[model samples]
Target: MNSKWLWPSIIAVLLIAIWLYLPPGIDPVAVPADSDSIARGEYLVKAGGCISCHEGSEGEGGLSGSAAVESPFGTFYASNITPDPETGIGNWSGEDFIAALRHGRRPDGSFYYPAFPYRAYKGLSEEEILDIAAYLQSQPAISHSVAPHELPAWVGRWQMLGWNLLADWKEPGREMNDDPEIARGEHLVRNLGHCSECHSPRDALGIIQYRDEFKGGEIPDGHVEAIDAEALNSWTEEDLALFFLIGMKQDGEFVGGKMEPVIEHNTSQLTDADREAMAAFFKRGLPASP
Candidate 1:
């Protein structure tokens, strides 16, 4: 046996075996098709901040996917999430929708750019994901074709595989010892709200740095920095809740810039209890300033 040929053949066989065993996208499942399911989806959409990106700010376009989100890589135009058969997700199956949210893959199996924030969304339960999908399907079908991302040639769908390798893709679970309020906050902040996706700094590879988690970082496009999570310690729970509810500080300073839409579309829609839970969680984690 020739040593060089033997090693090359063995490596080729191993690579082939690995490819064959790779899991395919999850099979399609039948989601609930009822008004109650759609209503639940609507609530989850707001909680998840879907409109903040899909639809431009209040004065801009509607949820027709006309928004262009700026990022370190380039400008990524949000896709049409409306139920338009031609340009939106109207034709997508339940599994197609779930795959995009949980695995960041399109119906054709192409990867979505991390700009979609699907990493945090991956923590959602299948029921929740399907509910959101059902709600999207109920929306008026708007025909809109988003512009392609302005990325470098080397940046492609395949690159997401490497990114996923380093990401926390597991679903979030409950802690038996966690306080109820704190637990609710953890779910909102870490899973549904995905607050750290923006507030934490990312490395050159665009991965969030866990060591600096919740410590302030620059927003995409380098225009503004996200407030550090610890900074909330300086604010009273009432103030924090007010900020989430209305984007206003106790000092009468209004939240402007990118956060305004988030407040208007997402946080503001949360129930008072949810806001209180978030406040309690933050206060419990960070010490109040002396």
Candidate 2:
């Protein structure tokens, strides 16, 4: 190779390497399943809010396709959630499904980006996650690979490893208190519902500000005014569940950013009783603002 061509050739190789190493979206493979398992899987899928994240607003057949989720880091497209063996979760086993939710590890052993909300999901029970997995397996797989996330060159994926260390990831569940009303509400909002993951402000390392609790702030996906600590001090418990169920309140307008999808999927699916308990829990003697 002549010296004049050497630099050009190297540049081409580098580009090729980056392209090849980019994240891939292979739909899960299909497996043989019984009717009972499929029904259980359906319930699990609804509980996990699968459709809200996977399906794009403009996607085909109300299925997950190429919906782009804006984040503090960058934009990430939701992958196809259909059961197409080549493009969806058809091939994933119950164990593989469990690993993704509980451990946040893909079948290939690569870590999933936190954009997937496994941070909140890490608290889920094993049985709960397995049920979700079974439900996903029942869906029809669609063969569509979303575009790879384009992170800035300064911030490599390896940097996420450092963030994870500081995160002190834990399994998804909250300790129950003696009060049935408070505990039921707390469990619904924190574990299965995951409101704080979006509503609460996070520290630089991405841990939720426990002191601030439901006091909301600007999250990665978008800004949420009055969710900050000060606003919650004045609101009643009815305020909290209404916020989740309707995304707005009497005193303020709805700050619907990423939360729109959540209401559409998770909160909307809850029974009226569950929603009320959640409201009661949020209203538990809110601290007076300093």
> How accurate locally, in lDDT, is each candidate?
0.79, 0.65
Q: In model 1, where is the ten-residue run with the lowest total lDDT?
A: 168-177
Using lDDT, give the best candidate's number.
Answer: 1
Best by TM-score: 1
Question: For model 1, what is the C-alpha lDDT against the true structure?
Answer: 0.79
Q: Which stretches of model 2 miss by more than 4 angstroms? A: 1-44, 169-174, 205-207, 219-222, 226-230, 252-255, 285-290
Error of 1 at 233 (Å): 2.0
TM-scores of the candidates are 0.87, 0.74
Cα lDDT tens digits for candidate 1, 1-290? 78879999999988975563354558769766799999999999999999888994344355777687777777788888888888888898888878888878888877789889888888788999999988989888877777888887877877677677766533233453258887777667777888878888888888888666677667654534444455664677788888899999867999898889899999999999999888777777533334
